[model samples]
Target: MDGITGETDSLGVHLHYDLGNGDRLQLLRLATVAPDQPLAALVPLDGDGLDRLEAIDRLLRTLLGRKIPQDTRLTPQQRRRSRHMLQAIDGRMNGASYRDIATALFGADRVNDHPWKTSPLRDITMDLVKDAFAMIAGGYRTLLRRRHRGS
Candidate 1:
């Protein structure tokens, strides 16, 4: 596999190919197959079968030097929120308090417009930090799937 990496796991040897742009494509090498050999996917019609199929399709396109498709599960708002969450976490890790993080994120002018105890930015900053910590504590896997409206 050109520039691909492999890691052994219970599922099998997982071959990971970095797609750049913070995205990665992984293929489970379940059976013996050479990199030069023609590859095929045998996805069963299970709960996550559709996701697996989409990944396989993306892998095929990647191998063919085609553009990989973006995941439609995340909306622009979600992407923005995720980025903000990382920023909040980074600020906190750098010894910044919630108010300081809010100041940096929302600007000092807006943060100064209201009292610290009642500013909405304070609450938003808190939530972002909490969400980021949750992601670090194994909740990041949920990013792979979209959340249902009622759930």
Candidate 2:
């Protein structure tokens, strides 16, 4: 979303999905974490398997109120929100803190010039923001891989 992060990291990517059901899914795609990695290897800090990807996908579809081919929905309103949110997110693409992102999206007033608080105007939840970024990063990585293979 931020022009600052016009590209993915050298090693991995991140994705965020906001299902309409009020459930948000955040996925971090490591540089080496291919989509087909054995499920056993996706353990979190507590060694728990990341089994929420499907649930996240389902939630995101529900949020869209319809099934769409791409990760993002196509309705006018949703598209508008996505565009604004993406742009705000992009402004912070260069590894900004969560508070900084909230401020950029919600503005300084909603954020009250504070550094640690969240901005009220922020529509997308924090988790969804995280997931969206992961997805974008992953897409970039996949693109690079394909380009390399073609070359």
Q: Estimate each model's TM-score.
A: 0.73, 0.32
C-alpha local distance difference test of each model = 0.83, 0.50
Backbone clashes for every candidate come to 0, 17
- Candidate 2 Cα RMSD after full superposition onto the native fold (Å): 17.4
lDDT of 1: 0.83
Q: lDDT score, residue 33, model 2?
A: 63
| Cα lDDT of model 1 by residue, 1-151, tens digit | 4657889866657888887778877767764665466657898897666667777787788777889888776789988999999999999999999999998888999999999999899999999999999999998877776445562
Best candidate, TM-score-wise?
A: 1
Off by over 4 Å in 1: 1-37, 42-45, 146-151
RMSD of 1: 4.4
